[model samples]
Target: MAKIAFILLCHKDPDAIIKQAQSLTAVGDYMAIHFDASAPRAAFDRIRAALADNPNVTFAKKRIRCGWGEWSLVQATLHAVEAAAEAFPRATHFYMLSGDCMAIKSAEYAHEFLDRRDVDYIESFDYFQSDWIKTGWKKERLVYRHWFNERTQKRRFYATFELQKRLGLTREIPADLEVMIGSQWWCLRRRTIEWILDFCRQRPDVMRFFRTTWIPDETFFQTLVRHLVPEQEIESRTLTFLMFTDYGMPVAFYNDHYDLLLSQDFLFARKISPEARELKRRLGVLYAAEGARFRISNEGRSLHRFLAEKGRIGRRFAPRFWETESSLGRERELLIVVCKKWHVAKRLVQRVRQMTDIPCIDYLFNEESCALPDLGGIQSSVEKRHRHRRALVRMLFDYYESDRLLVCLDPSNLDLIEDFCRDRAVTRLLEVECQVSDVFLVGHAMRVGLAGDRTPRETLNRLLPTIRNDMVHESDRIRDAQFDNHLRLREIDPPETNARAIAAFLGVPGDTAETLAETDHLFAD
Candidate 1:
């Protein structure tokens, strides 16, 4: 069995870090902890005392005052790597992780995966061409020299950097080195770490150049690893799962994200907050079950079955079983028309399709009554027995890229919406609430008589309460205060204005004047 060294860089949440260390210790992995120098001494002391009895664990002697997007972050990592190498000389691999990260897979499984593969697992790509590089931001990070202040922990203004650039005071990166950027987390062979250290020592200029570069932690190691390792020897994927909200904020995993964590093939997950006590307890149980040293007795088997069932591991794993390989690539946006009122949903779909050329999926329950264009048969079957709604939605998400947009109409079913959000790790959803008065008109449109042959007004009166309840439930689920990117359609606006707003929200390109005009005419009736 290959010995793996874990280099954990932690600043806050010492208890969580200790728990992670303990879980790894249970599986026989050596850990080298490097707490940020700027962090409170109490936190460092607590972690050190917690791991004192563990012979396999060591601490980095030289700690750096690590700051985000600064050279200190890279410096801290280097110190941890060196310390880990010295402490566990025979260790085959070094896994870099943060304080908030927890191993989702058992140590034995991680070892098996790494031991079978000779390639280093590092997520790297061209800095200029990657999807993360938005126009001016890429140039600001790569081209300009950013002076990061340790005290304030912020970068200098772009204007100041530009002035320095004009004065030829900016540090120049090596022309020979191809800049690569990726996720900071990586798993590498001991030999790779040694090579990187040697390479840095040999070329001090490279280190100096990167010191003033923005987010050097993301670029420094990646650039060196890509340069040193053969393309075939690189897996180009990290073993850690990190979920970011629509506004690009890192999501802290809670009970809601437990199933999502289990569904992933990644070995580890990050940003498990302290508030997620239940999730932490569950992780403890899962880690014990999946640990290599865990003996599978009758009781153990039963506990394992319970954990697996609770996690929904079997069902969630199948969605991404086959990787998407279509030439169409991932759809940028998904327009889901989910309305209880079939006619209203159908109308919205037609207006949206007319307004924007973006592809849409019409999944209304009353498919027969949805008198809309087939449009490549995106319409799903109304027969609930034929397909599981949540499963089908997951399939669509898996098929498309992560950046796609989904527009669900009349999502009165809060439970279904919650399931979709939880399964997909969707922190933000665009909710369009179409509040129409005159329930009798909608009832007439549906052409469904009430129980006991009651009049339309009486039937609507009975149904209104249920409709109101559903709306309230949905509002509670998709509370504006809860999510940063939950965009609600402005119901007070004109039909054309609302149509344009929806298009803009989905990031639909081109002029919406014609579409809006058409929508106004359609809704005019």
Candidate 2:
């Protein structure tokens, strides 16, 4: 039988690591873990104790503290790889993973999949220099020519300086040299690991590139493998699934869909806590499937037991499910038409009427709401802000509940509006800034008219780009508009109506506008 070694590199968080190990251990697979030196000593004790019973596991003899911008972490991981290689000398393949990652594949399936790949399946990508970056570099590299007369040369000089400053580099090198980045998590054939290590030993300067590169982990591996390994042997595509973490922030994996961990991706996703239980429960269906789908019993014993247990649990919860669904359907789909009092939100009611005659529930938040007849007090304010936010949350919840189309609008605050609804699974759109004003900061939050009819992936494809582009356009427009607003104020005696007038124009019902104007004395002078 071919041996497979699953290695986890970790810091602190023993509980989470152990939970992950327990799940992995249940499958009776070969596993090893390296707890980083910086992890609390208590955490190491816990980790050591947790895996002590597993014969396949081993704790490293050396540990090191890793700084964010340094190569220590990568080195530590490489060290773990060497150790695993020695221990499982005959092992066919190895998976380099993090403590935070969970296995979605059953041990058997995971092993078989790697066996089929027949090549190193570690997820890595080729780093190509963009044409723009390359085009500018040729003239900049002409240090001895002293031919700095051309505009492109000067531009290149300045651009290179700026990049050097950002990267904290003191020296300049020829730009013709190519660089690459590879994914940190990789599945490697044992031979590939031996070859890459040998190359690193032979070439010291190539290894030093890690000192200055922003993310050395990606680049070091890519550069080495590309230069040393035969091209056909290396796979450029990532065989495993992962959601990229947001830049500069760590610890949150938001709804990433990877095929391997799709079902139980987040089980060991974050540190254990009561607050995250709801998240776990939400993902439980996928969690059970992950294990059962991969368990490699010849008789399919584990799969049958898992499915039977899940079915029993499903039956008991069936009644509560329908009740919850009905309540959610009624509550989720909300119509929030954010306007000051008199402007587009109220007027756009006519447009909405054209779109669909679904007796829309309008929410008004602005300065001058009281003046409108029979004014329903929906003005956005500090006191009513929570109410408005809650309504927004409820509307999102409702949209998901109904799985039906819903729309809400916030003309001014698209960033905040996007924050509230990004995960709401709403078919969302952010209005371009050219269409709105900053004072109307609650950018409109209307459900896309066709959201309910599309699949989740389809909705995201339509909405994410529109929101991103709209935000960029709005930012540019705001910059231009700010300059125009400043110029207009300098030349004219503007009306002294304060926020109330702005509110009145915005379509807030009269009472809310009066309160806004009165509170700020916008009506004075």
Candidate 3:
């Protein structure tokens, strides 16, 4: 009887829930799924049938019909909370999960982490700045101004620019706390779930907002949690936000910002991709990499190897957006650094100056910068000098507010640098330490062990060749066999057999056999 009641919301994608449930089996887990009433009965029936066979699963009643822009999602989840409370009354905690999310940590670590936490691992958010209220709160004064005001819809056609300028927002709103919505994904203690239900039920006005609001699902729950526990430690950056989406979301090393997530530190990433399926198969390798302390050389070396292979033709290839020039014909500026020992920063500045004609600067800090040669000094004072030099490094970065390409040579040390740049709206930051090796493919490997997504056969055809040609070539051993095996399968196997073989080979992230099989035609001539 694990304490965490994993409550899942299943809508159109029963497969996602099924795969998620199946993956949980490795961690000694049980589940409760609330299939939305709007979902096709046939699909819901299939899921129910599967749960019948799975001892860990308890199918929840479909009580509410949730739509994309409505409050039904909130209502449905609340119903699930009620159902889970009644069904698993003895459970210590209740984790609210989506069908698509994949657990990032193993059972032991997750249990231990939850056991120690005092408050619910959940938060609420709302459009506190929206105009409908016409209240005293100046929309401009709120922290999430841009997110509430962004014209994603064409409802008002007049005086928008004039109004924004009057409000004192001169610059284009950058992606910040205001622009981005909170994650629907959350973990909560059982008491918290019960409390939320009681609180929302106590105030029907909160639930009634569905009739007038859009995407209330995103903010309602977040707002409630923040109100209930103002001082509780909350992480807005969910376990899912990829530290870097610039590299087209491939396997890469974790940086400092990721440390916040590591603190909660579950085993699986949110929304693990089919591309990363094979990598997920090797969880032992991934867990080790995720928990590793800062060691520059090791990370740099591993990165170099992985990237070198990424440049090869055996695996799938997607051109990085950075490689292309802007519509203005400006060369996309990129700062790439390989931090070896001392003097690396000096060389970086020199290279940036020489490589481009644009405004360029770099700062390097080392023992040489000190005026007093520590010939007679002890080791402690020498270390202090290095510390002072490190502090000076921030000044150079502060010179530019935004619109600069900042690259750090040692990515293992990138966490601190990334946090510094994230708040600034004008800078585009890229950190490449070394390359990725097989260890970078740990999630893909774990998907192997889990028996990955059963995507359709046709989808695999077009996708497989690219993966085999571009991404998979890094590991000659796997590449050699996989290439031959894929060719043979194309010639002999039907969609189902080929799908299984592909899953077996790639160990895809979660179960996507049906979807992958459909892609088979794309691979054909």
Candidate 4:
């Protein structure tokens, strides 16, 4: 039988930590907790008194005031691990946890999962080779000494970094070791833990180097593990499930994520919001009831595929799966017509149809839909936006049996705009930005049911942000369009453009292109 010891690092919310400890105590595994010195002493006492009766729970004597991206955190972890080792000598593995973490599965399952694998489970990505750090420096962090805590002392932190960059000051990294980066949380074998502690004892200079390294907690053990452990025996991924935003911030899991969490088999999840009381209660019930609430999505069952998406985009933002690589839009030429408003897109399509023989259709996405397009086989469905969008493109071409087709879209339909703009078949794109005159603003507001007993100026003030955001999104898409080799894109904002390019794309004589330059009045009525 494999014995697992837990090392928990806690800084806040004693009640939650105590609850976690009670659950772990019931599991009969020894757990060592380290409370930050910065936290109230009353909190530590409350937690300690609550868990005093549990023989398996122990608190580290040395409390360090931990600041984010500071060396104190690693010190705190070291103390907790040491305490856990002394308290439970027969421990086979050490699993790291935080106050925010909760076990998703039973303790026996964790032990059995570890028992089946002789390999050490920890995320240790090559610092230079992999893009493990999303928002932080990679090489500079290891090479230069960090002087201040980034989160608390932002000014000094950046100033010192800039000074180091300007002065070309760098610290010497141990040439023998490879710089590895990973989540600070891990499940390590007893041998790996002993080796790391022993190596630190022998290599005091290496410890001294990392003491000043930026966010050493993330790299200290991760980089050191590779020095002793062979690559073949190390599983380079975490047992804990964590998701980060594009800005490299961990998203706090809440009640809304319960369905998503039931789908994953990861041992634990971290950074759970303390305010998520319902989520916490449901999770407790899930384990107590043996997962009566656990259910896979309909899409996952019916489509014979995992319905969940990746990152926060899938977990929180989207309701279901979106297959970008669906076999619908393969090898087809499409002309994208877009506007901020569906009314503008609809009218723009009408104008394009009159000007050219190319087939143009409207209402790709009209969320505040007043009148939906009655076109058969090409109407947009929210459930399958990509499928319906590709169908619309196909219908236009198949209806005319032409090589290319045109489809109109609203930029305000944020979900579909980017995908279509960068779609492989999108060889041509035209975006119309209707100039918001006083009359048009009022008319647009009234049309969209936004104008309610307000002056046109007030409507403009209220609606300017939406229009501005749409324009900004459109601008970003057009800027990104240049990178897409297949895309030939243009924006008719302020009714200005390169006449020759517009003339060529529309297949119209440049001399007769007055309509292209003065498009502000197109929706003024």
Candidate 5:
């Protein structure tokens, strides 16, 4: 009989952790848990007491005070792995999981799946090839030295690091190391796990180097396994389902996500909070039914297909919102205003709203400038962060299938317009110009604390080159572009004239007099 050992890294919610652990318990299965050292002793004691009667359960003696983006997470996991190997030497496979993670499939099914596979199940991708990293700020984590203070759980930045990098300061990774990054969750054969342990013991220097890397937990094991295992022996599937938001934060699963969760064929789902008690109960029910070997229904298969297609479309096009095509059909015209300057965009939205009853939505990227909801929250797994803005615009287009659509592009965000046009052809493009000083003032205002003793005007002057660079890029990209409409903020006499011009561009009817008067007061400095 093949035996499996589970290594669980737990920090909070003792009851939930216990519940998840109990779900995976079976004869000949071993469980080794490492509770975070920072967590309350009482919580750890409670978990220990609950599992004390189980002969296969063991607690790691060496606990780490794990901090996010720190080496402690890796240390804790290693401790758990070591303990599991010691306690269950005969175990054939090791399944590494987090406290918040729950097994979606039954122990029997999971065992059957792994027992049939001779290869290790882990997700490993080249860091440079990953779309998410290429499209987001995660690349900085690889190139920069990020130091995390475990005591405070805060990132401490070195002011001179950027300068050092500019001056060709470099850190050399080992010649044999091929850096790989991916999901932290994995399942490995006992031999592979032991090999990893022995490799780490021999290469303490490699481990030490990883300690300085940002979020080493995500890359350390991934890089090691990819290097040690033969390419053909590795299965690139981590049987864990995780959803991330636009900001790279994990999306909290709720009861509403039950259908979607069920559609996934993964063995486990993660980051489930205690607040979603209903979802947990529902999952338990599904697990019981599936544990009995219940076949997926036709409806379930259809739903799965639908979800998979949606995911594919989302990755290629846009994030899915709950709104239907019929709901947005009432609007005859749709206007998308994209700008970095929130105040100006807000004013424009207000004027447009006053001018016409047709539904108008303003999407602003700068979080600090306005409270209006933006595309920043639409982080569907289908699209990378760099492609998120385009996905959002496409979603808007799908939702509001209006007769006419007007999109305004900010000079700084002209790249978005260019990408969007490339992906989906647009007949009309409108370019809006604002005073360089005004744009600089807004940028400076947002970075007040970082400016030290510099005045907003002085700071603007210093950042002029960067602003000019953006303008140059925008001009180059749009040089051959044909615009059906164009407006310069400073050139328009009376704010109403610009309002009327925008109304004409959007092909909507409105009382320009009232809109102009209202916007005049709004633009008054």
Candidate 6:
């Protein structure tokens, strides 16, 4: 029988942690917990009292303060692991979990999985060999020392890094150790844990060096385990599933995400929302059920890739409200197809689609009434759009992923156009201005609003020829004079010239221009 001990990390949420600790209890299993030293002693006392009846649970003798990307997190983790080892001398394995993590699979599944494998389960990759370090200074973390807290004192953190760069200050890794990076979570064999802990005990000087290194929690055990254990015995993957959004922000789980949690093959789901008692209760029910099984599926990795793909667009959004604007991805070449009419944009999108494989998204803001699920084609007003206009425009940009993308823009989307032209770094903004608006459509809208009856298809049926002829006649001069100030503007003066105009603006070859011109049937009688 495999004796697995869990080291649970907690900083706050005493009630939640107590429930989590209580749920994970088993007669044979041991849990060693460490409340963050910064949290109030009263809160810690409440949690300790709540689990006092459980003989399997223990708290660290000394707690440590944890800061994001700081060395203290590693210290705190090791402190708890040591406590677990002391409390359960017969423990054969150590699994590091946190208050925000929950076992998605059954305990039997985890025990069986561990029993089948003699090797350790952890994510470890060579610093230089892997592209795993998604963003920020990679090898620099090992080479230079970090003093300021990345989250709390960012200015000082970056300023110090810059100063170090200017001074050419560097550090050397010990000869025997090759640095590796991985997630803070891991499940290691008892002997492997002993070796890692023993190595830390022996290497006082090395420990001192790691204390100054950036985010050592990710590297300390990860690098040491790689050095202490042989290659075959150390699996370079974690049993715990973690998902990150743009810029490596970890996604938190809520009760609403129950389906997604059930789909993961991994033993545990991390960073649960503090208030997700219902989610925990539901998962807890499945966990204690008979005939529980460990499923193998690509959904975990697929979901990650899916979110990453979504993150590559101009914007990335999460359930958190702040991410709506904060998580914008790398900007790409943006071509704004401007028109007052939705049909004109639709026709241009069709022509553009015919010409190139580059993604051409249509009707970013549809002027015509749009049919939505459970509702008939409804017209949205300027006031309704203004409420969530930024999110609305940004979401469309986020849907299509490409190095260069073209999107049809309503003339009403001026704020969006202005925003794009302003703050974008690598993005090049271009515009195709369609002079396709006519007075006939304007009259039709008024008729619909006042008379409560208007047939656009039949009405436009008769006005097509007249609208085509008057597309850029003297009736439009005053309305069109102010377009010169737009970023990289190109014009479609007459209905017949849309194809050629778009081709010329995009710098397409002469032959392609002719092909595009053949698409003028988009404005046919």
lDDT of each: 0.65, 0.46, 0.45, 0.68, 0.64, 0.67
Q: TM-score of each candidate? A: 0.57, 0.45, 0.45, 0.60, 0.56, 0.59
TM-score of 2: 0.45
Model 2 regions lying over 4 Å from their true place? 128-178, 244-525
lDDT string, candidate 1, 1-525, tens digits? 767899988888787888888887676778998999988999899999989999889988897787777888888888888888888988999999887888666666777878898988998899877875543567567666777653464345556676877886745468888888888889999889999989988999888788888888888889999999998999888888786653567767886555546545577888787788888777766654654432211121222232333323223323232322221123333334344444554566666666555445554443445333333344345553123554444445554434453444455445444444443243345555555565434453234321112223433454456545645555655563354345555445565665555555556543564354345433222
How many backbone clashes can be found in candidate 6?
0
Instruction: Write the number of the candidate with greater lDDT, choosing between 4 and 6.
Output: 4
Q: lDDT tens string, model 3, 1-525?
A: 346667788676676566677766434456778888877889888887876877557766655766664556777777777777777666676677765455555566566666775666543433554433333433333222222222333343124534665776544322322322355667766666777788776766555433334455556666666655444555543433223233434334333213222323343444444445443344323332334432111122222343354444332323225322212112223232323221433343344344433334332222333333233332125344233322222332333432333333332233223323332223233211222333323333223221123322333333334433443232333223322222112423466764564344333432453344444332321
Error of 6 at 44 (Å): 0.3
Residue ranges of candidate 1 with Cα displaced over 4 Å = 150-159, 166-171, 290-525
Candidate 4 residue pairs in clash (backbone atoms < 3 Å)? none
**lDDT, model 1:** 0.65
RMSD of candidates 1 onward, in order? 17.8, 20.5, 20.0, 15.6, 18.7, 16.3
Of 5 and 6, the candidate ranking higher by lDDT: 6
TM-score of 5: 0.56
Provide the clashing-pair count of each candidate structure. Answer: 5, 48, 93, 0, 2, 0
| Tens-place lDDT digits, model 6, residues 1-525 | 777789988888898788767666653677899999899999999988889999888988898888988999988888888888888888888999987888887767777778997998889998788887877788788788889898999999999999999999988887778888888889998899888789888999789889989888888989988988999999988888888765567888888766556556578888787677789888766545557654343244443453345324332232335324542235555566665445655775687687787677566344434321221111154344334444444553555535566666655455455455443423333344444444544453443331112223333344345435433332243234343323323343443454455554555776776576555544431
Candidate 5, residue 106: CA error in Å? 1.3
C-alpha RMSD between model 5 and the true structure: 18.7
Top-down lDDT ranking: 4, 6, 1, 5, 2, 3
lDDT of 3 at 213: 41
User: Which 10 residues in a row give candidate 3 its minimum summed lDDT?
Assistant: 294-303
Model 4, global lDDT: 0.68
Task: Tell me the spans in candidate 3 whose CA falls farther than 4 Å from its real position.
Answer: 13-16, 22-28, 53-56, 63-65, 123-181, 233-264, 274-525
What lDDT tens digits, residue by residue, belong to model 4 across residues 38-137?
A: 9999999999998998888988879989988888888889899888888888889899999888766666666677899898888899888888876557
